[model samples]
Target: MNEQSLNLDSQKVDETFFTVKLPEQVGLSDQLWHLSKLYTLGIALSYTYVHTPFKCPRSYNVGYFETVIEKSKSILNKFTSINSSSTDKLIEFIGLDKHELNISDQQFELCNIVEINIDEILKDDKINSTSDLKKCIEYFGLYSKEKIYSFVTKGIYKFESKIEQIVRSANLDDSTIKKLKLPEKYWKAKEKFSGKFSIDNSKVKITLHIRKGDRTCINLNGKLVSVFASSIKVIDSTDYRDELKQSLMDTTKAYNLIQEIFNKYGEEYFSVQVLSDGYQRTFFTIIWAMVRGKIKLNLNDLKQLHKTKKALSKEFNDFLRFSNISLVVGESKQNLFQSIHAIVCADILIITSGGFAYWVHNFFRKSNQPSLIINLNSCDNKVVNKISKFL
Candidate 1:
């Protein structure tokens, strides 16, 4: 009648004493001398036969899970339960269906349970559901739910830390951080955003008909639609003015230096190699550079471009270390697993220096010379090549 009588004890007695083990135990302690001999086998058989699925139910009383299911039902119950049907439904409001929301990640967590089974009427003493709970106490060194709950809550508090790292590493503005409701502890905005412009869709026309204020996106007929705010950074006329001035200075300086070096070497060491990222400006600069100099680099022209076909790859990375360049860019576009925007900006700037080292093969092909050149960060660190014509 009591709780213990119903579940384990009764069932266990039925199998251990009344059935398989009992027959083996029947007639053995001497008259049934074999009974003692077989006692070990009987216990093993009893355990296997009676206690097959060693499930440790969380509670002896099913009420605990009953309560859980009730709670789940309360929140999820359809028209069949307490909440009545409504024209304005949550599923409709959220634009989703009941089957779609498995929002709970509970299944991903470790199972924390007590004994395998518990009936409400069967007290903990009767069914001893506390065995698994006792295991939890030993494992966690905390017997009370309140203690375990506090420890777990502390662990979850770390969730706040990760948000700050995301914010800082993203280089987000304070206002953006505030808007995201992120705490500052975890976000790390270590990366910078480098910027560069490129001519997209090279075949796209830029005819004289394309007025400064014209909608370039238009077809020949001009239906006056598909107006996209052109993302191309249109260089102002002033860009050429500055470039021309620099070109004059940089070109003259570099030419004079090259001339001096050439006069000393006299076609023996006098070699030149033109490097470009396939940009028209770089090509133009190279052409103008040759014109400015009375000297002509005969026998070769060195032109190498990456297979990527992009004017500049996303950014430069430590790969330049092998080439002896230290390039740092502010671009955080992770399209590149290695380099960033900082590398590109640095490269472009370095063209002011004597330009990149002449790669040996490139030198041999372009000019009859043996030079080791790598575009490590040559463009960003030096204006020598970029502005040799002006100087």
Candidate 2:
């Protein structure tokens, strides 16, 4: 890892060349954002190195699957770094035509997969700052801290070649990547609508983005207070049962919002898009759907029910039903770009406004789309009224 001359502290880390240390475990989207942030910081300093994404955490195990993207291979190579010589090599290396049913065998055959040396990375004092690329600037002794701060705050991040390469390199099907790279016509509201399902180009697409993987009341409290009050007010926020109860209530309201849209648009006039972690909500939706005779329960759902706790899932399901979800997109950290593309395409987004939701909101803001943020801890009818206008 230390073979590169630029890795030394005395030499001053290259201002134009910065290396990212991928986390052993991190949401893929978060990792991409960090990469983009570092790359943007480097561009401000005029770095010339090809912004290459490291094929890291070589064997990331999430849920029930894993894969290894070759190191130094550009995900966006096909889209951005157009070199006739490298294109043939990357295609041959990726082996897009090869299919293997044995996952273990494929992982074993991965030739370049190697663990990163965290010790070398941590020992370098010049690489210590995670903010404003301070460690990099200090190591190189290039710009003042003030200058770096300004770039960090004001730098514009567009869907440029660097990011395109990374997204192209993600562990996604070639078809999806190709579709994403297609002209804007493929993603426009009218062009992307489904006609057979009765979806029309004129319908407003509403995406209900649900995420609660690592949420806590403390975070929600701060967000709600900031949006609704002038100052922070102390309330008994540590009621675990109440927290779960409020989640159920908020979910019901979310379902009601979908129903309201359906009523207004006659189901054919509007479309519902769902982006969820899928554990809690999926469990509840399945149970409710079975009750309403909309869908029959299957063995796999039964297994998940046993795993997620049948009692709580049953209670939550009692009030919520999956009426007309046009599309339900699962959030897989491995396919961050696909999730991002879907989120960006939505006409209206409904989210919780923190954690992953906060990140999505920023993306939407960058693209100039409107969203409704629900603070579940203290969500009120007023928020619902505001959302109704959008419907």
Candidate 3:
């Protein structure tokens, strides 16, 4: 049947109905970001749902978009029919057995399906530059010509000027948005948190999130950290890699910088927290620099050193022992949600440039605290400023 046969207005159906199929392997934060955008678009257009290969983990405790769609069963059954083998593979990939499949009747099959390439959508000139919702919808072919009468009757064309406001003030009454705003478990766990480091609520916690690994563009360079060292006066040259490396390795400089920050912020009211991959030598070196003279050797520290002895480089293993600091060691081993929670709770935050950091600064952070952002990506300062305004 066609859209005209649907009799949308009499049935109280919105002008259009569609399901957006999200590509697989997108990161968690990125998936949420896209979903947030789609949520706004869905409200502006008609009933919308998302079909994603990845399910939101139970730890997040948020319902996926499909759970809220009125006719999710119909949508999924049709989707499965269209891409049968691929759907089976995806179900298997997520470890869902055949018994867990929830396919239902296609009695309410009135929706169109759109495979959304997030990158392409973002790159679309109409979407990127204009605030015209209808124009965007037409550009993306997200409507049924058979439902032309409903579009006109529903005054969809009249919403062009108010698109920006509609998008900005979109009612985020969904469970996903609510759960993200106040993650109860994340905060509850903070009381008895037992991670690589403990949260000290007594002091002004300053979290430094240094992005490393495959994302090299936004990696926190040694030179940037050396700027805090008052005793080190290395000339600013085009390439200060050698000088920066030496300065970081120099424990005295790290101690001097830490002392300066402690004195300035009040030793009793200041604490430093770091979130990054633990396997990097720079991570060990930086930790050693901060705690070298402050913390005395302990038995637990010895045990931790032995545990991570083989994982760390010889020099960094020695550094950890000399500094009396212990760290959870592995590639990308840090818990992202925990780090995000720490960032939100921090009185002051130091972050490197990236989409993840930008989103945290914009949507998740509720406090109007001071932040020192290292822009390594030559990113638009205006974009950063705009994100900060939202916080």
Candidate 4:
């Protein structure tokens, strides 16, 4: 749309254009990571990248889906372009007949369509490391040049050990990181909360993510109070419920270990904030049960004016009245970015096992302040190994 702002090189008259077509079932975080990969590859190969906006069903913020895509394109527009032309137009521009186009081909020579199959690549035992994966991509001539070295460098590796690099490099000054900034309201929330707590340099400020929503209700744990059970798909399996309950208990044990670690540091005091979708009763129940009254609830006054129902139970109300834990309830709603903002602000983060958590961890891998992160699902030996250093 803004040609000059796109920063396209005028000297390069002839350019290769490519579009990244992600799988239909991809989540929002995975979608962004794949786009980041495409952006990196485009820069390395001097290819013009086209973005095709995809649907995200799990997203709570309806506007955020479009906002991120547009913001990312504007920030990283050197190779990014919108889908302004039709498939017929693209075929015509490539000088290929519609009938001759083989949809099953791995790579369309004229119009490059990168079909990302991450699961397939990860299955290979030989491709265990990022270096190995990079070589494989190069070997397949995905973005290989005669003399140009591998664009997926060690710089990205230092930030995250994962194979998929979320950015072009680990340099935070780059536009890749800048593109991740959410709307102004989310930032304001962060700024407002940042001043309320006195974050100790010696102590760790931990933020644990306990994901409870329609999607994770069955797989992770059954809701303590099924307020929206009618909306959720009911799976009729006692074994499934048992497995999920066990997993949740394991996570609860991890939380207890974290509490003990803080206790050993000197005091058992630590700031706990629960970022939930809305005023979900299960979130309150889980936190009250696990945290044992070491928590603060900061409710937005403006948004609080709109909520009609008081979702708290009589027991929770009684606990709040006598306990030292703070409770400030209001009508304000929650969004996905707000949760992410909380993650970014935390010094120690314990997240659920899912794509969303992994994406947030990777995005802020090389944070300004050091953080101790534990994935509840994978925190047996791995988390215990990291715990000795902090203790």
Candidate 5:
């Protein structure tokens, strides 16, 4: 059958149809963000239904995109398609799955499917900012601010639940289950590849999220030195060193930060879990310098020593030997989500000044759960004091 024969004839169809294509490929987290944006846009536009042609290449990981997409489709069904009687059924009835529609799709000339330039739509004066793709969604004009918020919130919850399920499925052993059940008691690396370490539990649980990769850094004599873009630096004097001190909280500073939290919330109430690209080798390079005593343990140096594989692995492991503080380092997307989920559920949460940190901070804030977001981007003690008031 020809593509034109599938979709309804534009002149006769009662409902308007439009679609927003997802990026060709992206990380699972990024993909979910896009889907949420698309959902928001569809609800705003009064479009018949929003469609996504999300399919991964055979070479890439399969479950990452497909699993989240399935969960999103389920959530969309709740607000949109109720039964086979819905528009999805209409599309199927007309035999349209085989054809992929784009700007030049012949189907657009005869049917309701039409090319929509998001840029043109976003140029409207009503949209105040185009900084975020989600910001532009409000211009669709299909729903009010209240309705859009409700739908997007629902979508986020659905995706979060799916991520939790993925983590649960990956963790089937007793050791992993024990850690998840009482994370505070078993503050060790969750992934089997990481060497085991354990310590006593505390009264409070704080999840730390560190985002690395693509951030500008200097390779000094084979050692990695993280340089924050916002901080002022000088080639001579202690400016660069001092700036580094403020930008990242090293092991001692991290310990000190936790102690401060302990002082406010009570020593027995606080424990820590780290949600990051734990085993990512490149991110851990700075830890090499930390272990060698070339640099202090700071935010950029954060990551479970056991999860990483570096030439100085033994030295890093030895450094962890005497440490009283222990944390559960996230291994996968599901594991990371579980930590984030716990952070959202916990009475107290702490985050740094990284992009992912801000992302998590925003999540809790929108959920109406006020959290302690320490801007590690700057070392000013006032920032700590500001966080204390939140606690």
Candidate 6:
């Protein structure tokens, strides 16, 4: 465990990173955001590709590209650090003419698997920094007295804005939607507009983003008291209200489960918000929390090398980068565990577990979306046990 994210809070003598029981549900939207963002976070473990076109035998050209790729062990993760000599050798084997050779550069996608490491960052004192919280969290973990002020000043606003942005985009009452001023995009397919602040006139539905007042203590009353006073709140119909309520209830229950796990286990847990546009609001928030020492990587990121099927692994990275995310690409981790930590803390989940790490991640997926789970490490027994539950 990164000493930066976690420390011996109850250390009468010493503290250890044993898997302890947790009571509070550590369900934060950020966990899923980080998970989903792993496919999008732009922090690439970068190396230049040296293309060597292999013009195989006419018979070999008939072979599926997959077969040739597999023989070279060109899986998503086995990234070759290409150099000029390597490229030259590849060209020779491919039988390409030097005069005619023209190849474009391409990037090997990052593997979906991640390792979340809080202890490592903590040792180095790399907290998310908007202000001086970096220095404070370095000296103290998430709950340090010095960090408390910074948390309230910097962290709360940062975290609340994330949740608010997500809420504003979801279908909500016209009045509430207008007030929040969230990001919005028109859906040409639906002919109906959907955004952070949304309204469903056809469905007679309106959704309002209600922040977790008890947990965050945001600028709720300070601003809302005046805003709500000026705005005329709309009365919602029973059916429409029920649907939104159910959505919130279900999400809350899941979140509470994680919180319960955290309070009991004494582990770092957080939920990140998911946006309709596949934007990683939660992913950004954790990086924000890391600055404040509110969240850090867990111990699991260091424990194992998560495995996955090669194709699914490659596709996962491709989908996100293709989606046009610019800030970060893939979860900010190397190896399986670090990515896992970033995802869990970031709160965005991809919904598929067809890979090696799927076992531990099965329960974390949304039940309705079967395809979201990415199967990378498909053979492990523990990974299988977790995946089988949904099946």
Query: Among these predicted structures, which one has the highest TM-score?
Result: 4
Stretches of candidate 5 exceeding 4 Å from the true structure? 1-14, 17-20, 24-38, 48-204, 213-253, 279-326, 330-334, 360-370, 378-391
Candidate 5, residue 111: CA error in Å?
A: 8.7
lDDT, candidates in the order shown: 0.23, 0.39, 0.39, 0.41, 0.39, 0.24
Taking all chains together, the TM-score of candidate 6 against the true structure is: 0.16
Pairs that clash in candidate 3? none
lDDT of 5: 0.39
lDDT tens readout by residue for model 3, 1-391: 6887778654644434433343223433454455445544555444433332333321121123422352455456555543231333212322221211121214323333333333333334455323444455455554544221111111122333343344554443333343233234234434443464466766666555544322221013222323221121223354666644543333333333334455444455555555544334333333454455532334544455444434433322332322222222233323654566566666555555345555554454443445444343333445334333312
Higher TM-score: candidate 2 or 5? 2
**Residue 348 of model 3, lDDT score:** 56
Best by lDDT: 4
Write the number of the candidate with greater lDDT, choosing between 2 and 4.
4
Q: Which prediction has more favorable lDDT, 3 or 6? A: 3
lDDT of 3 at 175: 34
Candidate 1 lDDT by residue in tens digits, 168-259: 34343223312211111111112121122221221111100001111121111211111112122222243344433432243234334434
Q: Note each model's CA RMSD in angstroms.
A: 30.7, 15.2, 14.7, 14.7, 15.9, 26.7
Higher-scoring candidate on TM-score, 1 or 3: 3
Query: Residue 213 in model 1: shift from native, Å?
Result: 24
Candidate 2 lDDT over 1-391, as tens digits, reads 4656546653443332323333323443454354444434344434422322223232122222232233224344335421121212211221211122111233223322222232333345444223323343444334332111111111113323333343334422223312212123223322333341233336665666655333312222222111111112223345445655554455566666667656654665455665555343333334444566654445654664465444433333422344445444333432333344445555566775344544544433333446565554455657546655555
Q: What is the Cα-based lDDT of residue 266 in candidate 1? A: 42
TM-score of each: 0.16, 0.44, 0.44, 0.45, 0.44, 0.16
> For candidate 5, lDDT tens digit of each residue in 298-346?
4432543233334222222322332333444424434544554444444
What's the TM for model 3? Answer: 0.44
